[model samples]
Target chain A: MSTRIHRRRHAKNIAAQVLASAATLLALAFLVWILWETISRGLQAIGISLFTKITAYADQGGLANAIVGSAIIDAMAIALSAPIGVMAGAYLAEYARSTRLGATIRFLNDILLSAPSIVLGLFVYVIVVLPMTAVTNGTTTFSALAGSIALALIGLPVIVRTTDEMLQLVPSTLREAALSLGIPQWKLTVQVLMRAAGSGILTGVLLALARLSGETAPLLFTAFGNNYMAFGPLEKMASLPAAIYQYTNDPNPALHAIAWAGALLIALFVLALSLLARTVFARGKTSHD
Target chain B: MSVASVTLDSNRGRDRTDARNDALFRWALRFCALLVLAALLGAALSTLWGGREVLFGDGWRFLTSAQWNPVENRYGAWAPIYGTLVTSLIAIVIAVPLSFGIALFLTEIAPAWLRAPIGTGIELLAAIPSIIYGMWGLFVFVPFMAAHVDPLLDASLGRLPWIGTLFQGPPLGLGLLTAGIVLAVMIVPFISSVMREVFQTVPVRLKESAYALGSTTWEVAWDIVLPYTRQAVIGGIFLGLGRALGETMAVTFVLGNAYGLTASLLMPGTSISSSIANEFNEAAGLHRSALIALGFLLFVVTFIVLLIARWMLRSLQRKAGKA
Candidate 1:
């Protein structure tokens, strides 16, 4: 009986090992396939003209305007979210501590962190875009500002959560030393605590930007994708993800090629940002924490 | 006043200014923190207010009806809701076991040199954006599936009872199954990473004792590590489920966005997020409100899933404390 039990367990172990290895291989293979597909198709479609002009007409268009538009939108979003996130994080660490309101806000923010980006876009559309159209007598104008608002909403929770966690990691002894110097509360926070936690907070900001830049759903309802080189915030703006979305939806092969190129650009940009953020924060952790 | 008295007055005045500055700054920080909460409430309130037109205009029929005609101003959410649930369920089913296997492989079996690099590479998967996943799903994955896997399923069991119908159809490749598979791929990193973390938290002593009892690697993983982290593992699954439910771009590309109910996973269908994404732009007046209402519904579903997940996590912490 003992021998039989031992043999059965041995077989089970081998089978389990096979299953585990297969899963890992599948996962790794899928990753390679995606990167391979994006690069091969996207690289071929890239051209000097692709970055120098607005999408001229269908198969003739470049991604210049879309790239610029994404930059403008994400910059605006970071500008809006970072200050608010940083200050709120300070309050959570410095003042509120574990107060009722702080805990509640933290909980809700955590929910919003995982909330669908499209829903936030709808919220912004209902609040900003739709109302703006109604006030303007229905011209159907999709603006960079509206896209920024949507992106900001999507990024807000990420920044707040990161700021809060990073601020907590700043040691309490640092705060006491700053206070001993008779520094004002704001100065203590800005000069001492923030300096100590700077890299972690910056990591959070970069990660948020990385997250907001790839968002196509929210931009669909807000930016709505301009086909020309529009420069105004109130003007409809083209974005790389939106461009990719539209191009792939088109039945033309040339359009599909452009979409692939746009996908490659967005993927590389986001990947680089995240890797940079990770390395920066990982260095901070090893050097300090 | 004497010179000493004059200097004392100035010093006192400076102290007062500093104290006031501290108060003002403290209050400002507090207000900023309040803004985060305000934004959360504002989103929920505005979504509710925007959907007031739909909520009152259509009543419960919005949830019950299957017909969606924006020109005629009519809508029903049953089909999209069903699609969302089914796709998420498919994702969880495909992802859970695979995530467990990968987690076990990383924690219990992998060689030391390969571990860190493999773990880091797997996490790089999260850095790829959802829209890119959508693009890949549309351009590469769809064609691959339509060419190979769909035909195999059709030739084999496309004639059975319940599940056979799921494999029925011309294998267009843009359907529920494709969306589910894509979502499965997207969520693997999340669930597997989380599972690996949880599995690593199992007590070293417990694992060592199990090994000493002549238990094989698989037995230790299945009988020892599995039971120890079961609740935490479930919580990780729910986290992935929450993501799958609200996933928009990737699912939108592959889900085909057709509005009908069938057991056929091969059939084209629409999810709530995809419905909102596809129609929210051109949808005017009532159609617009209905789409916002859909967004609201998606929010509620994901919110509930997250809350349950949090509850599970809290319980798991308690379980760990007792252990």
Candidate 2:
């Protein structure tokens, strides 16, 4: 009877192993399948015109305007978010380490971290868009400025959390060593601690940028996609993800191809950013050690 | 003597300036931190204020009713809410076991040389944007489902006596079940990575002792590791649940944007985020408010789920630290 029990258990073990291996294969297969579809379709749509021409009607044109617009919006967003996020992170690490208020803010910030991007869009729509529309008489509610603000909000919590964590990781002994030198608290945090945690903080920023580059839902109502190239932050602007969304919805096969191409661009950009962040972080860790 | 006195005065002035600068810098940092708090409060209050028109107008009926009509200016949250819950439920059911298997494979089964690459591969899956998933789901996956999987399911599961209605729909293939499967794929990386991390936290000594007792690998995983990391495992699952619930783009593509709820999982349905995404652009006045209300609801729901997950994970971390 004991031998029979052992035999059944061994059979179960074998079955579990098979299931696990299959599951891993299945997960990897889906990844390959998705990447393959994007690359093959995207390459077919690639051309010089894609870089030179502005978008036209459903069957024609390229994504020049959208790419440029994406760059502008994303750049402005990083400009706005990086400083504020760094300071907030510094505060959390330096002053509020054991404070109740700091803990509460951390919790709320975390909630904000995973809060739906669409809701942030809505929040901006109501807070910035509707008010601006009302003040301007509906001619300029949806603008690149509003979109950047939403993206900045999305990026903020990420930077703050990473900065706080990275600063914490900078061995308390370093803080004591700096403090013992009679350096002011703010200067010590800015000079010594920030320098030590610089790469990790930069990694956070790059990851945030990668995340923002692909965001579509928040931009839908805020940036509100345009066909022509518009440089001013006050005007509705085209972006890669928004353009991809529009073209994907279009019934034209040609437009669908362009959308795939755009998706591939965004995907490659995001992957590269993340890869860069990882290498920077690994190098930082090694040098520190 | 006169030059030395002037230099002393200058040094004192510099010290005073430094002190003032230090105070200013400290306040600036505090202001930035407060700004983070203010952003959250602002979002919540503004969403509440925007949706007040619908929330107060519909009262509690909004929660219970599924009817949505723009022509008559009537709307309810029932259908979208139901779709959101059901799709997330389907995602959890499909993802949890697969995630467990993947986690087990990563932590225990794989050879040492293969681990890092496979782990990175899984993490890369999480890095891909949701919009790409949506695009793929609409053009590639939906067709694949309609042509192949739907008919297979209908032929087999639809023939069952009791749970057959779900499989009995026309093979349109853009429905709750399809969206759920896509969501499952989107969340697998998150769940599996968390699971793998928590599993690794199990002490090598405990695992070695279990092996010494002649326990199978399956027994070690199922009985020992699972029990050891119970809270964290649940926390990981809830984290995935939070992501699935708030997911917008992926579901928006393949969900067919249909209104109303049905018993069949094959019928197309609308989720809250999809509803807001599809209509917020064209909607005006009350219609717009209703969509905002839906966004508000999505926020609150995800917030609660993530809070629970954070609590569980934090508690476990504290216990680990203490040990």
Candidate 3:
């Protein structure tokens, strides 16, 4: 009787295992389906003119201008955010230790980290765009500079948190050795500690860049959409995300196809960034080990 | 004596130069830190100031009034507020159980070889952009819901008194219900992954003890794993809630952006983000201020919720440390 019961129990366990595997496979299949659908639809629109020409009359536009605009805005955001994010991270990790201020900063940082992108856009609109409109002359409008600034704000908390965590992961023994050499605390941080944490910091920056690159909500109010390519930082510029939004709404099927292509490019960009970050961090870990 | 004096003079010069360099570097680092603090402060203060007019001017009336017309100079955010809350609540109700079940399955039941690929697949879902989700929802998911899911729900549940009212609708493809479902899909991966991580923190010894006692896998999970990771699981739920609340583009596309409340989930409604996205460009005068006020309320709601989640997670971390 005991043997029979044991056999029944083993059979039930095996059934459960099979069911679980089936569910996991279903979930993975769903992901692959989405990816395949996106790629197939998106690839149909890619062409030579897609990379070299500006947006033309309604149906025949390429993404050359949008790509340039996105690059410029993202680059500016990174330039503005990196120094501040890294320094704040350094303070949180090295200076504050476990003090009350440190705890407060950490908590606030986490809140900022999770705060919604739409709220950030709203904040910028209320604070920057509306005020500028109220005070300035005629037809005050959104600019690429304003958009980049908002993106920088969105990127800031992620970089700071990542940098802090990575720096903290550096063992205290390294710090002690640097101190024992009679180097100042600041020098130890910049020369020894930061060097050790360099790859992690780079990964964090890359992840931040990946995140902000796809943001559409914040730019809506800050950059507004432009049809023609305007190279000025102060002018309205076309970004891949904003272009996707506009083209998706267009009545033209060709424009809709272009939107798919734009989305594919954006996805590819994010995927590359994440893969780069993973590679760097993996190398860093192996080296440390 | 002459040799000793020469060495001492050189050492003194080296020390002076090092001190100067260190001082400059420290000053620069401190300045940068202050600038970061300033940026945070600026973001907060400007949001507050920009919305201060509406916040202080009509205060309570601003929230209660339902009207939102720009040309006639009347404004209210009740519809948007209601839409945001209802959709998010619906999303959480559906998502929590599904994610929890998936997490349990993955951690306690799945075979070893199946785990890694499944985990990676779920994480990849989190990586997909909101815009792509919006596009997919617009073209594919909404039509599917309208054709199949809505009809089924109406046919089955339309007779029950309370539940019947919820399903009663024109079966339009885009509405609050569709938005809520999309949100559930978007947030599932985040909640499940966090729950999985927390479950792994449960000590191996505890599981081994349960196994030795002949406890079933489900029994071991219910008795040991659930209790061990309860706090973290709650934190993970709140994190998912935060993401759902703030989700914009996908919600914008499917929500239909109507400015009213209705008993039927099939009717169109507007969220804070969707309203802002749909109308911010054309708004002028007090209309802009009112919209900004709506944005302020959203910020406050999300900020408080996120703060609470952070506090919960911190306490959970402390408890884990003690254990």
Give the best candidate by TM-score: 2
Model 1, A15: alpha-carbon shift in Å? 1.5
- In model 2, where do residues sit more than 4 Å from their true spots? B1-15
Model 1 reaches an interface RMSD of 1.5
The 10-residue segment of model 1 chain B with minimum total lDDT is B310-319
Per-residue CA lDDT of model 1 for A1-111, tens digit only, reads: 988988898888999999998898788888899999999999998998689867757788789989998999999989998998888888888787779888777777777
Selected candidate, larger DockQ, 2 vs 3: 2
lDDT by residue (B160-245, candidate 3, tens digit) is 88889988888787899999988887888888888888888899999999999997776677689989888888888888888888
Question: What is the DockQ score, from 0 to 1, of model 3?
Answer: 0.48
* lDDT tens digits by residue: candidate 3, A1-289: 9989887877766665565555455556656766776788789998887777777554676888888899989999898878778887888888776867667777777777767787788767766776776777635668888888888888888888888899999999999999998787778989999999999998889988988998998998888767777788878888889888878767788888888888899989988898898899899999988
lDDT by residue for model 2 over A104-200, one digit each (tens)?
A: 8888888788788899999999999999999999888899999999999989998999999999889999989988876777788899999999999
Proportion of true contacts reproduced by candidate 1: 0.76
Per-residue lDDT for B1-323 in model 1, tens only?
A: 89999999998998899899889988888888888777766777778888889878889999999887776888888899989999999999999888888888888888978788878777777778998889899888898889998888887778777779878888798889999999999898989987998888899999999999888999899899889888888888888899999999999999998997877888889999999988887777888888888888888889888777766766776666687
User: Of the candidates shown, which would achieve the greatest lDDT relative to the real structure?
Assistant: 2
Residue B101 in model 3: lDDT: 64
Candidate 3 wrong stretches, greater than 4 Å: A1-30, A130-140, B1-41
Better of 2 and 3 by TM-score: 2
- lDDT winner between candidates 2 and 3: 2
The CAPRI quality class of candidate 2 comes to medium
